[model samples]
Target: MVPAAVLALASLLPVQSSAAQNHAQPDQPAKALARSILQQLIEINTTDSAGSVSATSKAMEQRLLDGGFAKEDIFLGGPTDRKQNLVVRYRGTGQKKPVLFLCHEDVVEARREDWTTDPFRLIEKDGYFYGRGTQDMKDNDAILVTAFLLLKKEGYRPDRDLILALTADEEGGSSNGVDWLLKTHRSLIGDPAFVINPDGGGVDLQNGRAISVDMDATEKLYADFQLRTTNPGGHSSLPVPDNAIYHLADALERLQHYTFPAELNAVTRAYFEKLSTIEHGQRAEDIRAILKPSPDALAIARLSAVSPEWNSILHTTCVATRLLAGHANNALPQTAQANVNCRILPGHSREETRQALIRIVADAAVSVRYVDDAGNVHDTAPESKGFPPPPLTPEVIAPLEKLAATMWPGAPVIPTMATGASDSVYTEALGMPSYGISGIALETNDVRAHGKDERLPVSSYYRGLQFYYEYVKMLSGGQ
Candidate 1:
């Protein structure tokens, strides 16, 4: 449920924002509303730092209600005031599968000491909005809500219904938000033809180029593994050669030494081939040759020659992120544990990764246990052909691709794989084809997502608002 504080305050504001809505033209009013609402939301501490989400949910709910959504169409069902999920619906003509535009509301804690301005408040400087969740991704939320509200006010009945979910705890697991919704409120999210999450996109090849549309048809599944070694608890005064610390360290070292086999499936192959076409000079030739079957040696040579970030995309990676051992400085500790986060590429399973780890460690002294099994695994013959790639139905992709061509020509539209996860995982798991499209036209240098002083380019955010309107119209028209 929404927090009393937010609801009480919302009850006092004008129930209908028609006064502000009437000030702008119908075509541009949605974008204006998006900007206005985003500025208001930036004022709230939506971060879970306070361990409560009622305030944020209420603010969001009120914003939607005032924007034109019916009160019953908005929902708030979750644990308590600390974490509440928001769902708002817009009516449409019953002609196509309803489209679901998903995003999260909760943001990671921003370090005030590290930021130039208060991260909680919107700081407009030099045309950009400096605030947390601007890119990762309050901008998308604002644009989406604006699109729905304006469509409702204009009485534009879409061919398909529009369902909007502003989930909680996306930075954490989905246990509180999407996961619960899918399980408990399945009917609310009708069997969608597909979903569009505005989290994944490609860097522009150059300035003023069409932002490469990186449609993530596939993503790496994460499996967390814990490595532990036990030794007798003894005084620090009496040191042993094979103590828990040393054993755990050796296991980590071994893990570092061994690398999971790099397997390029159809998606990666298609991705690189497209990259090969637009990329210039030597890089293009090397990339093109790597797409050929039996190009392992050539691919490895080329990948290793490039940056580590690029290398990771060509392979499965494992990194030890958390280490746990002794509690007291004086104690040597009887047990030591390390948490290894592994990102397994497509065509592999958690079990296969586990077995690979066992081979790497090759030590009986250290035991491996999985913390969370995120995906199911199945064994298939290495030579057997797998399912064909997801069909790019023109009905869903044409407008998006056209926009890309218009915005960025000859930019090599590639079907890329997301190294990180997104809310699309839920829709994809539900058997609906999903696309992650963010209209933000960004270069490769921008990096503040889940980092210090996150900011969004003013042009990109505004353009995204336009993109949403165009996309909704195209899909609803079946163009």
Candidate 2:
């Protein structure tokens, strides 16, 4: 009962054999190298733990040395003792400024018991390689390293010096990683024409399909502040006008009620305008209205209600995460504190956000302060040698998108604005246009990132190998 056109299309497709499916190699040597590197990485417990990076760095250093990278070029960057950073450089012909590939070797803590397999051991089942750092970053690091080593092995030189930085402690802040490296090793990344941090930006959603070609040109700001209040302590039996907890609750209520002004920036405007053309009906009209210079509140309201993913694109959002104050069950607490985190659109300053928060609380008793001060704003540079994402070029994205299309036909390329942050923050802070690009392919609805049983399909690992090999070759001005 299949339609004639469908049958005809199926007939035209080349039959893929079982062996081809099982042992499919996209650039066999590169695939083997990337997979091998990843397995070694997963084996090391490189969290913020005591001995994490030492072992991991040693393994990576040995690998680089075996590939013939100069021992001096593989020195560590960070505090002398614990897990530190790793840097590798590949010399190229002096035709252009070098393209710096930024990567972080640290990962978030993973609970051993919560996982179906040993999170530190790379487990392959039904074509998926499951491990702790599979998605959030190891996949990115693996490809870049493989590409660097391959170029070296082939004796191919790039137009500019290729600098590869793998830093530590990104799961926390750059305290131990890029922060230290940038401050101490400025000469290493200083002369680069532009840089690419694969930590932000992604494909955009179009119609019911995702446009896989879009890349994040910018990222929202991150601000974490505390809402604190103090009041007179008394016995539980005595009534008070407003207790610490009560004041905090009232402030939370007001914050939840008030919505920040929604202003679509240039990047988001371009994003939606492109999507509207590909979508249909109300969805299309809604997108069109949202992109207008002066979008109506109704349009904003509708879009915000659609998804947190979409709401983030339009307005700044605040959420109360932690609370502390009460001491004993029967005793009245003297002070109470609530933690509020906000993700503001790019170009919004942390100071502006802090002031807005003060106004929102509007309570005489409460005082506010920030928890992490990693500078919540991106410092954009003009006349940089690249496109909208200055340091990250259209040159790089073009090839990456082409790779994605070739690897997964029918998968749309949608430029994305990531809600979460990554080590790319360090590169961005250095005024390098950084992005979070990877070679993994996921179904439209799969959510494997930073989750238990985290995994990447075996095909994705191999495809990434090929893409990076091609990418490095092109960037280096090679064949």
lDDT of 1 by residue, 229-315 (tens): 888778898887878888889889988877666567777677666556556566667776667666656656666456454566677
TM-score of each: 0.85, 0.85
Per-residue lDDT value at 125 in model 2: 95
Over 4 Å off, model 2: 1-24, 27-29, 49-51, 174-176, 201-211, 237-241, 373-393, 409-414
Q: Rate the local accuracy (lDDT) of all candidates.
A: 0.69, 0.68
| Candidate that scores best on lDDT | 1
lDDT of 1: 0.69
